[model samples]
Target: MQQCSYCVNFTPAFQIIAMTKPATLKEIARRLNVSVSTVSRALHDHPSIGLRTRTQVHQLAQELNYEPNKTAIFFKQGKTFTIGVILPNLSEEFFSMAITGIEQTALKHSYNVLMGQSHDLPELEKRITATMKDHRVDGLIISLAKDSKDFEHFNQLDKYNIPVVFFDRIPPQKTAHYVSCNLRPGISQAVQFLIKKGHKRIALINGPSSLLATKERMEGYTAALHAKKIKIDMGLVVSTDLSTGGTEDAMKQLLALKNPPTAIITFNDYVALDAIRYARRHNKKINQDLSFVSCANLPITHYLDTPPLASVEQFPREQGEKAMEIMLQLLTRGEELKQKGQFFQTELESRLELIEP
Candidate 1:
């Protein structure tokens, strides 16, 4: 009546015990009184395998704790069933949520994800891409670094017959398919909210000048200002790299101006949070002394001591899913997959309330 150490929940000693070899498919097939091919087809969920027989084979394998050798499967199929994911940084909650969506979709399709971070450096980004290529990944998903102005790093993927897809912070040249929020309507909505509050002088804290999102958002800000018959005040807008230090510098510059803006729009919620912190240093109450709005409306922004006057919530999860769907099709199909490559866009603008007054 002796039970195995694992079954008895014993803290077994590694030196005293021998490691048990994993059960193989052949052993399970023998136990089930079935051919090896039949067991494999059943394990793979082959449509040809009868449901009743498949259930019996699966139950037998479970009893044996059978595990298929993935290496053998990969060798036979000539596919690693792995995808590489490159992001500027994973600390940001926005990228984390987007990654969650990508992981979910990749798992459902029985593919593995290889992750890499660029840390917003161009040379590092190139190195990561090269490493992923060396791994012979089946596909790649990327959100380019702030300094990645050239697409040559990703060009290697094409040379290796690997598909690359972009999302959120995409490359400068849209040579491949990408999925991201349309920033125009979101920025327009945020600016209009400030105008509705009777604030004529508005300022923008944008991301790096090289980013496509920054350019698009600036355009939206300019268009909104023109529509309201307000001349674009070049001094009011401060283009800074998206960072805490950058945001603080921008806020200080605006506060120093003799004619400071009554409202400010930021590249993202994180930037707005930094602005709020800066405003507190100067004894300026947010939404009272100055109205604030930002893009990428993450939940953390809402929990701040002083939340933004409004925010724009883009569908990052959907963007991730759409990017994967396109990459999958392109890898499996050919030029026919181009239909799915069409940009998938969504928008969500916060309903501004007079939180201050």
Candidate 2:
């Protein structure tokens, strides 16, 4: 009297067959009163299969809980309708929000996403690229890791003709279509705001030197100071890993300086939050003793004890949306696909005033 989930009759052997054995074209043809070849063509919604008959066959197959074998579909179509996403880490709020945008876009286009986190490791990024190629993802979206300079890992995708678009943390080389914030302007805005508040002695907490964002931020920071006639002080610019430990260590060093900066600009909200906490530990009041601003703001910054004096809000979701849109256009429009191997650049940049006490 036990019930089998897959089969209505619930016979042990039939249950095994229903659960483990895929419904074949012949089995479906027998059930639908059609030949095996007719069933095969109907499942693909082939133009030769009359619409009414195809609909009837498909409905019956659905009722029987039949699932198409993905391997067979890939072999026949040469496409998996699957894309891959490579990120530094999904645990970050910014990247997680970007993922939501990517998912919505992929679903709209009837494509699947395969995600891999490189964790800022070049070797892992290479492995992920290889795996996605083996799986034959139709396209790829990536935010390269910090240490990734040589893009030979992505060169293989050219042979497969799978397009790769770079977003957020992209490389310096102009190899792929990219969607990102215009960091120089954002950083310039943040630094200018701090200077307006009478912070002539300012410092910069930056990411690694090799990173594209970090280099652009540094340029902006230097430009802002130079425009204001403030001499560039090498001692005040601290390059940190942007992770908690490295940021904390950098904060200690910056604060311990002979003439510590009264204001600091950071790479992202997390580094800014760490700076605030580190300042508090040293008995320094946030806005009074040490004002802080960051380039990319997130939701968590608003909940802090003393919110950032200001933050630049780069629209990460919009970046993700636009990146996918470009890739989809390349995939669907045959004529437009002639623009393949072209680098399309789109920038999403915004600034927000956090206005802390």
Candidate 3:
């Protein structure tokens, strides 16, 4: 492949010194010996501006590197042309893919995204939400922290007319707007696959009970067992705080059961990895004495020696696109949706997929 001339001749940053600030219309007008309004009109090619005036303005703007102030323009239009997005963990592959979709969607609409990570702390989430509100962002897209408890931080955004769109790990019992995965389909597939393989004692390692996602996982796991006429065993289920130690603890509790599970369904790929390590420490072979399945279908799992027999594909990138789409709708509808006391709620199906790469 031939390198572009521009790339080959690019200046080294260390050698480039004393770069000038971007020129403004006033500077261009002064240089062109014209009024600011005349320069603006000429630059915009207004019909009233003559050819000679436009030519001079364009030439001056090019020489001075003059550019319009988009912030001022958006401010005049009662918008910042920016949106806020908060996530629990950016390092997770699922969240990384979600960010990719979010950035792509935001770019299409000519909006900039301001990202924040809560690191799974409610206090940090609260501060980030406050910061977003102060930023006067057009809208917000958030996936709540695992331990997020208070809704007041989010509630205050409503006062500023900032629309909130919750994606994966959405808040429980709130209905303004959200685009999250429906876990039933994927969890059911995992559970049934285990059952078909004669693993009757299937267990689940879930997130903290405080999390709405944990409840969703629980519902899906039991519902799947119920559909197959398998007995629901609370003893087979364990909850973790989503830490490595917590995951190992959950695995220990499950292993100590009078009749330990033959297979396990984990909260996510990370949790599964921790559990697999714990199982190995206890001399349980992966996918033989004990098999596993997980959510998120993180690519890291496929790279491991013994990945899950299968994983629930949450399609986080699609979730981000859907969430951004909903945010756009909310921003467009503005007060109309609020006035009507109506909201936009949608769900993307979670599939049992993503393996054999």
Candidate 4:
């Protein structure tokens, strides 16, 4: 029984791979005749690990092509060094910009991002969150699903000792950590700008009542109108699901009023585009028969021939970076910071950006 040349050559190579398939910490420990923890400490050059032991471990590690498993290394420290990010829709320019900021900031701290898009569905948002929880992500950053109101999924993270930071679409209840844009200032500014332009009948096409942003828009509208001695008109206000059809319906509602508004303030540029298109479809002259102002200041709006007269710059990317920074602080500054009741919230003021349109 003579063995084939191929079999003889493959046997040793296959055995070598079998021995180091994973090249785990336990394997290294067994080889060095040391405890797993001891080998881990020596690899990290901890002071408790003697210099000779550390040196030998390093030399052996280099010779054996032993790469430290980051998962094991982080597990001992009770961290995954990975954060989860959930967004309403990754296709939106605003959220895409936010992702860029979050990823860049996470990279600076040697962390990885696990991203999920909820597509504005509440159930999808909950599922994504649960999946991330199953993965044991150290922290989570979310721009909530537009339709989500229960918030129980967000609340459950607290029970599991996971820190979550919200940005853009913050919950009305301020119990958890968040970074958000205060839409009042910018909305008021937009209202005043419209008033200055001699548009007395201003309409508000806001989002669903579940959102803090919708409430802020209503507040700013009334506040600005009050400041200018104009009576607030409930008939001029309408709510939208923020879909193209929903925005169109809101525009129709406002336009149907006997005292139709000469100007409209929409939730965001996306909504404004839809509203403007709806008006155009009805033969209304944009910025003339129906002037428009919106929020989000999305970059895609710049390419539109008739963008909003002005938009509120929410600084999505800055908000994202700030949110990530907060998550890092909560994670790195001990568990007490991310405990049951303590919270860190930062709100940036939205600025009304005047556009050529």
Candidate 5:
């Protein structure tokens, strides 16, 4: 009769066990024959709590899989302990490296990071900014999209006293903290290196004319050519949306010129790759018939059989680290402690490397 009764109670017993919730602080206190306040102070490592009690509390908490209620803590501290990052393209090597730096720095400070990609679209950039604001992130780090002309979306964050730091593709704002690379020197060095390799007719496969990097890079190219007493040919400069097909189109147009360039400088590695493909199709040998150089020396370039002759390193990771550092300082030391419109630039020459042919 008892054996039959055991089977009859099995289903109900399982149901009761399934309904039991996770262990709580009160439950721990009851088990240890102590007051709830005592358990709380012990878990918090309060100075008044005895060392033995704190150790016991920590051990039991771990055993019970206890986790503090972050929502409740947010209410008490008025901070979400989270930072939001908005980038143009997550697939790009530059942004990916930058994210690693930002995440590492954030975790070291016990803060969480939330990321959003705009895919280089203006409207999506606005939506991403709005979503980050809605989540009540303590701060924001952003690299403006290729077509992000309006910055009104960021003004809402200012209304809430939230600080913002820009990195890489920064906007034209005069009152924002920024971390960037000095493009002029890097571009100049790249061009001069190509010239030294005995390539005089140099073409530039640039990105959208609106980008600040594009402007700076163009300045560098022009300056380098001027230093060498070479005439600036507008025909050699082709502006594209930086799409694969756009890059191919730019390459085709350059190669069709009456006197095509013997060397080329691209905006980034992606453009450089497209140029390589185009050159191969036209029976041109990279680093031989046509010297190549570009920015954002992505890791993949090192593994390629025919890598660029040289790549200008932008130090994306350093940019991210600096941006986070500035953000944390603003958060802890207050906005007044930082000068308005303050900007930091990572070292350019250290990042540039000449790939052996």
Candidate 6:
């Protein structure tokens, strides 16, 4: 017998083609000699269905790899059983931790999540939001991008009766459901700690001025300075896009002053890391010549040879979990409940540790 050129064994093409199609409820019913409705009810564990019959249906479904039609389910329930999450940057440790909480909570509620990263671009964020709408997600969880100014994209979701829950970097909308950490106490404490250590000239390397978190942190910084009777120095505070290069530029500018700040506070760990590198290259030692503090106490800080003076624990994971919980409530509850809107303010304890060289 002549062997086929593609393979040594002669496998029939029809067999390969047959395996590609997925098993369906109708197929299961046909095989089990039951009605399609009976199979569906049994799979759903409907109370009307007999226990033995349900068990038989489940066994046959496992054997045939039968999967329910989600489209039909959606039609019946008026929900997609899916949630959409939009983040500024997926690579950021804060967002990464938040995603874990969001995903875990979503899974517990039998809902799937679809994630989109905007990379801090307004246009891209709009596009991603549109895509989420097209996917017909039941609800949304969002952290606004750094440069996001236009919120009209979200209006479409509102028009379609989709609930939105904001976390971390939320938008300016007052009526929206959101979860955020109260940054004032931690930031104020950090500044107070620095002042207690006799550091009068302090510089702030902040994220975009448009961001809510940045605004809050700046307010906290200024309040602390005012409390200590120190005049607010506008020149000492630098705003950046929070990119590595942006942070490095801000550090350079601060270091070039005739009387530069003895201490620096940054937006997040990545910005702090960049500032530290820049300071070291310019002959400044961490915790010696220059004291540094930042937000988002990432795990890497603990492992660093020379960690920052302190890092404000923002509890990204908890923020994510709370946002998910809020979203779930909005989805499960009626439209009237969603319209009421809820805001969760998480006041995580601030952790401050001064590193000694």
Question: Cα lDDT of all candidates, in order?
Answer: 0.81, 0.83, 0.88, 0.89, 0.86, 0.86
- List clashing residue pairs in candidate 1: none
The numbered model that scores best in TM-score is 3
Writing each residue's lDDT as its tens digit, candidate 4 over 1-357 gives 999999899989989888765466777788889998888889888999999889988877776778877776788788888999999999999999999999999999988999999999999999999999999999999998887888898889978778889998988885778999999999999999999999999999999888888898888889999999998889999999989989988988898888899999999998998998999999999998889999999877888888889999999999989999998888887466645557888989998998874
Q: Write the per-residue lDDT of candidate 5 for residues 49-82, one digit (tens) a residue.
A: 9999999998988887777878878978989999
Rank by TM-score, highest first. 3, 6, 2, 4, 5, 1
| lDDT ranking of the models | 4, 3, 5, 6, 2, 1
Off by over 4 Å in 2: 1-22, 31-34, 42-63, 333-341, 350-352, 355-357
Better of 3 and 6 by lDDT: 3
Residue-level lDDT tens digits of model 6 in 299-325:
878788888988888888998899989
Q: Is candidate 3 or candidate 4 better by lDDT?
A: 4
How well does candidate 5 score on lDDT at residue 34?
87
Off by over 4 Å in 5: 1-20, 25-39, 45-65, 338-351
Looking at candidate 5, the ten consecutive residues that score lowest on lDDT are: 341-350
TM-score to native of every candidate shown: 0.81, 0.88, 0.91, 0.87, 0.86, 0.89
Range of the 10 consecutive residues with the lowest summed lDDT in candidate 4: 333-342
lDDT of 2: 0.83
Residue 140's lDDT in candidate 2: 91
Please, what are the lDDT tens digits per residue for candidate 2 over residues 243-263?
A: 889999989888889999999
Candidate 1 residue-wise lDDT at 40: 92
Measured on C-alpha atoms, candidate 5 has an lDDT of 0.86
Model 3 TM-score relative to the real fold? 0.91
Residue 191, candidate 2: Cα error in Å is 1.5
RMSD of each: 5.3, 3.9, 5.9, 3.9, 4.1, 2.8
Q: Residue pairs in steric clash, candidate 2?
A: none
